[model samples]
Target: MPSFTVVTTAQRYEAIVETGALARLSEFLPSPAAKVFVVTTEDVWQLHGSTVASALSGRSWHRLLFPGGEARKRLSSVEALAEEMVSLGGDRSSIVVAFGGGIVNDLGGFLAAIFMRGVPVVQVPTTLLAQVDAAVGGKTGANLTSGKNLVGAFHQPLVVLTDPSVLHTLPEREYRAGLFEVIKHGIIASEPLFRLMQLERPSVLARDPAAMQQMIAESVRIKSEVVSADEKEGGLRRILNFGHTVGHAFEAETSYTRFLHGEAVGLGMKAAAHLSRLTGRLDAPTCQDILDVVDAYGPFPTLDGIQTENLFARLVNDKKSILGRVHFVLATRIGATEVAAGLAPELIREAIASTLR
Candidate 1:
């Protein structure tokens, strides 16, 4: 297994990226373990339940089904899962296995954070998006009516297991859409990672094991480095939200039903790249390069009928906003970014207008 260690003030854990990580779950579980709660959605359970069951055969465990979707990412779900855990005779020693995609990882991690005042969670992310981003970061939360991830905690997982082979089961659009996040890693820190995605679309889209592992491993390294430096999103971590500000607005306006999170992020990146150019932080050629990768990744759902003004206004509610000024991570070049606050309203207007229409 190819692994990286993430160290934070609160905890340290390994993120393992390998072809058969599912078989290795037992190896990473806490020794002298008590009960285990496997939190996952029915769809994922149906596909991989047997594999997981076999791997954890000797352990005492119960499967907790989460109706997975952005709409279901709520405090209600967290509470319901907790209630289930208590009914199952769970206690502080009972560990949670968050075994699903990004949404379940976030929801389950939050569940473990609060259940018995924070039991351990081992994240086994099943989707491409979850593998590269959500699984590695200890940031766990659910959506709020006011904004995305408004209520959450920095409860690190005991470990994270990412098996790239599982991505073969992902839907075509979903798998490709998730690349926007991998692209985010590249743009924020590594030009080579960006170039790999840019140049290897065919191999990546084909799910070539080499291409997939390389993309996933490198993404984990970047995420581990960033999270290790700033676990709480207090400073350097803000760059991880490179395209999320505008992207989240699209999700809210559509009520989280229309686009996958990454699809919305793809649009958000377009707007951010344009904003970078408009702000004179990034040159035209570089801006176009960023735009080209976003466009290449997308025929993102048409932004028509969705008001850019509404999207622009939604920025104030972004968790990144302080008082009312939206802080944006602007690309100075591929593999580099600078955080900017209090962007001019006039420029914000143009950035949204340019991509959202």
Candidate 2:
């Protein structure tokens, strides 16, 4: 029953984090809806749908399975899911229960935002990455061939329910990928949190319930505060995109198949740290400290053949970039970051070359 509220100018929503919280889904979705659409992947449904089904036995609901993986996160998928919802009698009163990892949350949230001129959504995040990052933020959208999340809306969910127990079924690599966000949270705002990860890396990876719960709560709190203050990525919120500038570029260059989102961000952080040192924004010791934490999460996917120039091409296409200027988020030190604007492409290229080597 550990819960917190994300307060925004538009509305405030609650996020519940606990073991076995999925069983209490009814409590959150109390109002009767025309229909409840559970949007998830086939593999996830096969593994955990029954539990969710049993919990919603008294309610009228149907499950919609989308193809898993980043490849399927497209406008086509959103159109297909919306068509299915309409076929299933979904309307403005329908509820979309996003029930998987980040992809599911992003797609479901986007679907909810557009279906019947917008509907409500509840995020039941199953992966650590989703629980701590994607599930909380109201950011939702499908990726275009040009860039990630190029077409999306800032539609907030009604509630976010995280059951840490579902994380037990996650593969080790996936779990490790999720930790990159937790590490990012620490680097941006919580030194003690960063130190805790350094001290208890083994226990955290083992998914010790107590450690996991605390880590998830803390990460959510940090993000909740940031999102509350800057709901639309106008100002302070850009800090959350610490590793995303280059990270999104890497994903686009590789076609989102080579590395997980968090894995790419992990590499992006390494590059950002190098740029931070090269620009004298962060000292050598702090830069190494950042790299040490990132290395602990490795061995990360290498960018052996990917050209730095190609990465810069993708980087400029990022939605955050504007009018030929890239708003690069660089670390000032552990627990702090600053957005460097008008950075030349060559400097970013140098940083990428330095880190990827």
Candidate 3:
């Protein structure tokens, strides 16, 4: 088990990233909880629910299961879970333990934040995507029918426990999907990490748990640093959304059925790089290098079939757009990214073509 910690002004929590963490919950939870609720999916509960339940053998426990998928990260789902908790006699002091990936963490965390006004929640992230990115930020939300993450709250988890061992059960596509965010973190903060992905031979990551743990720790540290500086995304926190502007649009445009979040973001970063080159922010060689890294990871969903015009129309509706201009997060090069606000629609369209071409 690899251990990691997140330090924030509100509080500090430790994440134990290994197998059997669910079995160790008795030692991890805070005292004086009236009841414990595990928010999860049926599949997740089927796989490891008994172990978790066994760990809390002496305590009163309730389980809330939702169908597992990105599409379920909605306000209705949040309301359903909240209603279930209320029906189960949840109180302000009750604890919610989210036991799945980013979708569960986001939905469950948001529900815990609003149910009874507020309640303490624990995050047990089971996927690589959640372990490194979404679960750490305390940026919890549910997608509205109109847009992704449209209804949400900023509620930090009382604690987070990550078990990388759980990732072994993840589908290959989903596992590789997470590498995109890992690569994104490297590009934004640590040059060494960026270079590691660039220089290492293919398949090196498969044999290297220590390397993976180190990368996750560094990425978490970068995130913690950013959150510490700007908890509410007033300034530095926006940097964390590096590829999200275009990426989210791509996800929404496809209705999230075709590309996983990280896969779409990987392509989005590539598209943003093309835009950066057109604006002279990045040279062609630098753009190719980043694209090469993404390609080396393989399995990028094609943008050729997606209608660029419709994609741009979707971009115009992005939450980041303000005053009739879309803001793009662009990189001058790997290891450096910036927000280019108020980009004209024409330029934004051109950038997408150049990067996705």
Candidate 4:
């Protein structure tokens, strides 16, 4: 198993990436855990419930299922799940296993963070997107009607277990959408990674066992380094949101139905690259390269019915914005980025509009 510990000011946790990591779930739980609550979606639980049951064969455990979708990623779900946990004798000693994709990880982590004032959580991210991005960061949240992740917390997990083998059963589109976050990691910290992803597009998209395990570890390493240095997205961590300002807008405007998170992010990366070039921070060649790779990984859902003005305007509600000014994480080169605040709306709008066409 390839694993690393993410050190933070308050606590430290390990992220393990391996083919059969989940079967060893018992080895990671804390001693004297009064109850184990596995928060997952019906779709995921149906697929992997038996494996989990076997791993936790002798433990006191329970399952809490939510219908999976962006539409169900709300505070209400957290509240409902929390109430169920309470009814089932959950207490401070209860530990949460967030055993699904991004939305489940976010909701489950938020559930753990708030239940009994706080509890430990083990993030067992099943999807490629959650494995690399959402599961590691400790940034947990639910969406408000106005925008994505509007209500959230910074409760770090006890550990993260990422099993890439499960992805073989993942729907094709979901798996592909997850790759965009890996690309975002490449854009954030490693040109070498970016080049490898572009060069080995075939194997990567094919989900070759060797290639995927390596990619997951490297991407997790990059995220761990950033999170360890700036756990709260204050300075260096802001680069992690490279394409999300516009990406979240796409999700919000579409009522979270038009595009998957990573699909919206794929489109957002193009817009960010355009803004990078338009603002003179990035040269045309690199900007074109960014856009090209994003497209190579994507035939993202068409921006057909997405209103340009409304989508453009939604950027203001992004969590990254400050005092009503939008801040964009723009790539200065393939591996590096700079966060720009208060860029002109017309320029931002132009960048977003460019993607729609």
**Which structure among the candidates has the greatest TM-score?**
1
Candidate 3 to truth, TM: 0.90
Error of 1 at 348 (Å): 1.8
Clashes of 1: 0
State model 3's lDDT: 0.79
Model 1, runs deviating above 4 Å: none
Per-residue error (Å), model 2, residue 260? 1.3
| Deviation of model 2 at 76, angstroms | 2.8
Model 2: how far residue 267 lies from native, Å: 0.8
TM of each candidate vs. truth: 0.95, 0.94, 0.90, 0.94
The alpha-carbon RMSD values of the candidates against the true structure, listed in the order shown, are 1.6, 1.9, 2.5, 1.9
- Cα displacement (Å) at residue 157, model 4: 0.6
Candidate 4 deviant stretches above 4 angstroms: 305-308, 344-346
**Backbone clash numbers for all candidates listed:** 0, 0, 0, 0
Single out the weakest 10-residue window by summed lDDT for candidate 2: 26-35
Query: How many pairs of residues in model 3 come into backbone collision?
Result: 0
lDDT of 1 by residue, 1-357 (tens): 699999998898999999989987888888656899999999999988888999898898999999998778999999999999999999999989999999999999999999989999999999999998998879899988776687989889999999898888998888987899999999999999999988988898889999999999999999999999988888998889999889888887898878888988888888899999999999999888888888887777766789878988888887668888898889999999999998899999899999865
